[model samples]
Target: MAIDELLDEHEQSERVREWLRRNGSALILGIALGLAAIGGWQWWQRHQANQQSQAAGDYQAAVDAIQANDKSAAGKVQALPEGIFRTLAQLELAKSQVKASQNEAAIGTLRAIRTSDQALTAIVNERLARVLIDAKQADAALKLVATGDSLATLEVRGDAQLALGQREQARDSYNKALLKAEVGTPQRRLLELKLTEAGGTPPKTESQS
Candidate 1:
């Protein structure tokens, strides 16, 4: 019992002396690192919250402007003229633009989104291709398809192939889409329609060359 007590006292004394030896520097560095980590986390959390809040507020304001039947006001207040907002809003607004016989303006909106948002660029390009095909701008449409941003969803790829006069390829895309979709699903029905329109049966899908 005495030996153990003495050993414990010696350990406590060594720890005290060691702390005294390194005193200020060790404490400062430990405090500094803890503060740096805490500060960094707080900064990141605040920044993320701000960006999300901004995106949400901007979206709500634009929705309100649209509900008031003011296209010009909505456009003016929207966050982007050529980026994320421009992509979704204009895409949503394109039908209205077309109904107003503003085909050129609708096309312009989609084209602008294609340049600014790489994440959505592929879908925009795919839609742009369809619009161009409808307008008989075949070469331009093909170019957009070639520079796709995302994995070409089967629907988009099928439409692109049909536009390019590649009926076989269109059938293939439709077939893949049908397989990916569940039986009796709406997506499967859509793919079937596309295949029928292409005038070809589904081909056996091997590795994409």
Candidate 2:
């Protein structure tokens, strides 16, 4: 009986060894594939980090150029990747252009900042409208600021409407601007003056909660 049991154990061991010999290569291949997948993911993460770092450096350089009042500030900004930083750089460049009496160039620069962000779009539109108004393109300015809700945007719209001799629309826009502006602030005072110009009275200030 002892000899029979030893033979049985030996048979079972041989069967296990045979199974491993048949399947070992497949198991090794699966482990290799998993390791390759992990390596690929790590490489992608590193690549993305490097790209972001480079973009940040380029954006900072453009900002520094603008601050230094470099004549090439716009060129530096134009070379940046399309993003918020690029949009801000363009705005700074447009301001510089306006200061240099380059109204047409400033209008073109401001119009180029077409970001998908709502806040950024609003800011760009407000700036573009102001430039248009300055250029005596009141119709274009009115179209740009027509849907805006902010105090500054409303003021620009009012300015445009007034320029077009649309006194009633200008009065409504100035009133809206006054409502959005902070009480006792210079902006509110200006809005009040505009409202008066449009033949409307300023509303009494309410406490902001």
TM-score, each model? 0.59, 0.84
C-alpha RMSD of each candidate structure in angstroms? 6.8, 3.4
> Mind giving the per-residue lDDT tens digits that candidate 1 earns over 65-176?
6556675643643454444655566566654555666667667766655444565666677766767766767667766665432334566767777887988877777776
Global lDDT of each candidate: 0.67, 0.88
- Candidate 2 stretches with Cα past 4 Å from truth are 1-23, 206-209
- For candidate 2, lDDT tens digit of each residue in 83-167? 8879988988888778888889999999888699999888888888888888999999899888968888889999999999999
Give the true-structure RMSD of model 1. Answer: 6.8
Considering summed lDDT, which 10 consecutive residues are worst modelled in model 2? Answer: 200-209
Instruction: Tell how far residue 172 is off in model 1, in angstroms.
Output: 8.3
- The total of clashing pairs for model 1 equals 0
Could you tally the backbone clashes for each prediction? Answer: 0, 0
Assess candidate 2 and give its TM-score to the true structure. 0.84
